[model samples]
Target: MEYKTILVEKRDGIATITLNRPEKLNAVNVDMRLEFLNALDELEIDDNVRVVIVTGAGRAFCAGADISTFESDPARIRRNLVNLKREPRRILSFEKPIIGAVNGVAAGEGSQWLLQFDLMVASEKATIAWPATSLGMACPYGMIRLASEVGRFRAKEALMTSKFLTAEEAYQWGLVSKVVPHEKLMDAAIELADQIKRMPPISIRTIKEAVNRGLEGYEYTYQAAVNQQLSDDFKEGVQA
Candidate 1:
């Protein structure tokens, strides 16, 4: 599918999706959400693409949801929220391993988005934060796997404090596999993808499936978080 909010490129058994709304720091809006789902659909069935890399253009990986889009009709808001909620499951269950080349700030829902990836490669300037509590929403997707990645105490502290972790700090906490210079973020991601592609496809897919098996049970929690989008507090927070 042709995309406006993202650029899709395929080469050497790998596909890359670059979030293109750099002017807004690649903050996701409705169009980006729909286009991303469509792009995934296209890539999923392509036999030549063994791995995928997700990154953002310009200064930020993804600053999170475009709040301006949040002040919409109630029903539309619920529908959009529901659509967004399905993304985590779709990504987690994908057959090909995904690497997040986090180039810059990845905050709020952006932080949650990275958690769905099989691996994360951060740039030296990258920063990650989960600010959902301050925004009056529970990040069920993020909450589920964060403790598994970084331990319960650290995850709780990060979530509650809503502070950005530097790339080195994130690496130290085991949130990202490695941190490279800003200019080499995609190169590092592509190198990892190359290594993954060299492995037996079945073995890689099986390993990913086994790792994500426990995450499937969080669907109910995700549903509950989506429902929170309809609450007055959430609306008030958005409007503020």
Candidate 2:
């Protein structure tokens, strides 16, 4: 399917989804969110697609949600938050492996989405952080995912203080699986996807399902918070 904010290309059992709004740092808007969901749905059922990679068009992967949307209509604040809460989980729960190719800075909600990927390849020039607290909003999912990726204390510092970590540091902290030179980010991601394509698809799907089942209770809680964030406080924070 054609998309306005994203470009989807599939080849050799690999599907690459590029966030196309580079001028705005590929920030998530309503259209982008819906298109992304649709693209994922398509990829999930495609028999030829064995792995999926998500990246951005230019320097940044995604800076965050588009603040301009909230500026125009306060109600969009809740809408954006709800989208963030749901989409990442959907990507995480997908049966096929999903890889994150972090080409540059991935901040705010973008950083949160990175945690959902099964594997990650980040450029050496990339940086990741969550600046939600600085914007006067709580990032419950970010906090939980960050802690799970790194450690509790470090995640707290990163989220509360909005500290950005270099790609090397992220890899060292176990946040990203691999760190390569900026130009090699996509190549590394594609290489990994190729390796996954060579593996038995049924085994990969079963392992993913079992792992997800192990976290069934936690997933439900996360989804609930994602839905509950569609509240006045979240809207106010987005408007701010």
lDDT values for all models: 0.88, 0.81
lDDT of 1 by residue, 1-240 (tens): 678999999999999999999999999998998888788888889999999999999999999988877754667866776787778888887889999999999997788889989999999999999988787777777877887789989989998888789999999999899999988988999999999999998999999998887775477667766667778777787777
Residue 153 displacement in candidate 1 (angstroms): 1.3
User: Which segments of model 1 are wrong by more than 4 Å?
Assistant: none
The local distance difference test score of model 1 is 0.88
Q: Mind giving the per-residue lDDT tens digits that candidate 2 earns over 110-173?
A: 8877877788899998999888766556564776667776888998889889888999999999
**Cα error, candidate 2, residue 34 (Å):** 1.0
User: Which regions of candidate 2 are displaced past 4 Å?
Assistant: 71-80, 213-240
Model 2 TM-score on a 0 to 1 scale: 0.87
Evaluate residue 67 in candidate 1 and report its C-alpha lDDT on the 0 to 100 scale. 86
Candidate 2, RMSD to the unseen true structure: 3.1
